[model samples]
Target: MASKVTPISGFQEWLPRERIAEQYVLDTIREVFELHGFASVSTRAVEPVERLSDQGEDADKEIYAVSRLAGGDDEARLGLHFDLTVPFARYVLENSGKLTFPFRRYQIQPAWRGERPQRGRYREFIQADVDIIDAAELPGHYEAELLLVIADVFGRLPVGAYQVHVNNRKICEGFYRAIGIEDVIGTLRIVDKLDKIGEDGVASLLLAAGCSQEQADRCLALARIRTSDTSFVQQVRALGVSHPVLEEGLTHLASVMETAAEHAPGVAVADLRIARGLDYYTGTVYETMLERDPGYGSVCSGGRYDALASDGKRTYPGVGISIGVSRLLGLLIGEEGLTASRETPAAVLVAVNDEETRSDSIRIAAALRSRGVPTLVAPKAAKFGKQIQFADRRGIPYVWFPGAGERGGDAVKDIRSGDQVDADAASWTPPAADLHATLVTPGSSD
Candidate 1:
């Protein structure tokens, strides 16, 4: 036997309750994506190495190469995908001929990264993503749509308040160029670290990139103006939008904010400073943060790219958002206050009256299942008390006890309130609320 168990760094597992929270996030993602007309699809976890090559050096390094035993070789060029977008782009390219234009998809799966994990960052994590790919140029309204849907996802969750940090690479670059900073693309790389390295570190890098203190401070100040409202448009104007590029960025942000507010009221806002650390995005970028928990950072973030994917013929301009499912679930589950109703699917467990009469219990279970209830039967003909304990452990609140005689055939118990009554197996109804899994209400303290 091995001397001890091995625990890998930067990876975590979920216990039952934690798994329930994770499942809740996944379920809500599917619901919201479908409600917005996005069809669901998933791509293989591994992809050709070239697929994710369009990312930054940091993102590229995070690609966890597949093991040699898994068909990887010195000549083989494939790695586990680090994010949903890259494989999605490849999926679109390889199957473009078959797919309809303006393809909308939602993917929920685990992604691997070889990174130094921190508070909410992980090496092996699950991401929930939704994207819209268009054959022609996608309007900025789609950008707002991406943020609106994702914001609504977390907004509906039990997590505390969150704001979608909105920005445009166009706006940031325009503002940079307008402010006379050369190599705007190179400068954005350094400034993206403002959250990690601090203003002083970014300023030093800006100086290294030949930005003057005035220009550096202005760029830093611009990145700092996040809002969930249209106030940033006014703020950017005060920053002097004389440069046409900065003005364009300003107008684009105003348009996105206006559309989001109208369609998904109060869901998005303009923050001139949301530099989405990726090079591909030429337009709007979004990052959502839990209002009171910056420690968890942006639970969802993505941006728009005009030409990130194309077949050298038609361009597929795209915009998307990804929610760090495992991370957000991690924050909510053991949060000392968050709660989920069920750990298993059984809404009601049918009690066994006697070992000789196991068929009676199975009959009762079928009755509940017919009523669209999830019912679990005892493994063996156990005592009534044993079945109740089993249901209680799994948090299956309602237990049905088969009656002794013909007229008194079915009786049920609500384990939570300890309420019991004789009712027919065919038509007896569990309380409306107890009929299905109950999601904890937002900001609930149970």
Candidate 2:
């Protein structure tokens, strides 16, 4: 009997060409992260279940537990991390003595969750994250810097017209308390569902949660406040709610929006409703969405955490953002037909004239490879026409002939254009554009 092979629902696997395209995106992300002076760090995939579960509201349900099939009862409980941030918090604690203050690091890794799969939501996904952590206290300017960092990243990618919706937790907490609502987190969780359930639904839920009709209406009013500039400060003030925390949140959010407007125009919006569900985020939360579809959940998000990582004596407060690499690629490459120019990276395939003279073709390929040109030798001593067909099938643009030039030296043919010219293996170079596989999207001018 033969065993059946099946793919799990949420684990994504791409074809060869698609994988090459994915690498291009990853390389670009890594280069930009380095340009900003963020050091790379990788964390273990699993953490103690207790630590993972403490992330906040509704987080424990998503954790995928890990246990050995034959392990004894003494094994410590573990679970695959739902996101990179949790493990990163633990990493800081274990290595705090050796790390410098205001540490900056970037991590790119896969995370797992047990949630039901849906569009742009996956059980297994890749996340590219950057965080800045400092001992005891962190500066507020880091929040503004993170928004610019995300803008820089998206500006380089093909993701067109996205906005980072910004909000401060203090604004919500202070405003809720001013209006006599006792449950700040509970109200935030419901308001966060505004996109899923419209204004009426949220109002009903708020009322059901024991908020007075006026309080529910007030909460809805605050969530609806959104602006592209620092003007949101006045908008909150117009609502006639006042608290020291609310005043502090207004000032903080105003500074962030002002910085974004001056440095990264049109990239950040002050959206008061963006109360991230995680309990760890202390202030300044963000959620990014494409301009074309406001409902397509956030592709990048994070926030300021004042006490996520702490030792008995010290605390590490930080602000960070994560790009949902898998979700972004799912929309770009899977549905939008983004791909690479070739299935293989080889730019030139050397042809063998005969079985006895195949050594000549191998030597030519070796010379090309030495010069950093991606080259491959013919698999068989097939006819020249058949060899050309093989190169074409694999999207290899050029085919090299060992000794087919007019002067009996050597030649290379651009199979796409049918242009054959004399060339030398030791000195020849492919055009810069042809040297490596290039990412492409359907209907793109490039």
Candidate 3:
């Protein structure tokens, strides 16, 4: 019996044109990551449930446990990884003996989470992550360098006017300590909800969590400090708070902002309020926002984790960021109508002139394919108009007609403009722009 077909909530599926656009985005990201010297790595989908839940985040509720219906009692329990970082950490530990230190790698894979889905959020989504990890200690300069890597990737993409908001956990920790507040993580957890519940709501929660009215106000003040330059340091100092840890955090953040100014101008901002919510981030944290639609939440986010990857004998400290590919595409392709110029990769369709000469069309297609032109032969020997319509419906730009010229040579027609010209199968080439599908934004003229 045929079952009813229905779209599953939180699961994303794209049509052919949209899938082409997604492939273009993924290809651009992979190319840029490799160009920046990051090696690619892919880990398995499931890990020990204990490892997935060990991270000090509220991720346990979102974990999808994997099990077999006929499994024995001795079988180990496993769960799908909610994020790439955890599994990558496990991979590093398992292979530490063979891999070199100061390793830089990029992982692009899908992660499953059972959280409630909303705009730009999904149960199963693709994440592109880049990280640099080293034994014992990692340099602070990598925190700044990763920002430039993200900027470079977005520079080539059509995502317009985005900013990478940089913050340090030490700044929040030290500031909370200086103000006579205990339970720093608890306070951060509450403040992270500021976007959801307004300032009054956060203040109320802070007070209920045993914070004095004055302490709550000061926390709010700290969260409001945001700057595009090093001036954020001075502004933070003016708050009448001082601690050694606070000073250390300010210095580190200042260096990151200064380096970003020189390398990735107007791309990084020092936002003091961005407490990444994850307890593993011991230092610099990042959250990216598209200027066009900040309400869509962060399209990319990550931070430095000092103890995330570790065994008893060794610890790998690292910093990284993940691009929420599905989230970004949900807005660009699904909402704004961004798409590819064609549904298929084929740039030219070899039309079948007649049943007796179908082999000629196949040979022409083979010749074009050998020359790196995406070509396909028509399925049957249909009328000239019908064959042209087949190519048109698929957005194929050119159609090749065998033996259609006056001198018994092949002819190619620009289907869009209806301009036919005599051409040679051996040497003719499609224009560079038309050789493959190109991304088309909402307002741009193709």
- Give the whole-model CA lDDT for all candidates, comma-separated: 0.79, 0.92, 0.93
Best by TM-score: 3
The TM-score values for the models, in the order shown, are 0.92, 0.97, 0.98
Q: Which is better, 2 or 3, measured by TM-score?
A: 3
Per-residue lDDT of candidate 2, residues 1-446 (tens digit) = 99899877877789888899899898888988999889999999999999899887888999999999999899999999999988998999999988997999999999999999988889999999999999988999999999988898899988889999999999999999999998998899999889899999999999899999999999999999999998888899999999999999999999999999999999999999899989888899999999877777899999999888987678899999999999999888888999888889999999999999999999999999999999999999999999999999888999999899899999999999899999999999989999999988889733
lDDT of 3 by residue, 1-446 (tens): 99999888998899999999999999999999999999999999999988888775687888999999999879998999989999999999999988898999999999999889988999999999999999999999999899999999999998999999999989999999999988998998898888889799999999999999999999999999999999999899999999999999999999999999998899999998898777778899999999999998899999999999989888999999999999999999989998999999999999998989899999999999999999989998999899999999999999999999779999999999999999999999999999999998988855
Error of 2 at 5 (Å): 2.2
lDDT of 1 by residue, 42-90 (tens): 8998887766756775777888766566453466677899888888888
The parts of candidate 1 lying over 4 Å away from their true place are 70-74, 226-231, 264-266, 440-446
Ranking by TM-score: 3, 2, 1
Better of 1 and 2 by lDDT: 2
Residue 316 lDDT (model 2): 96
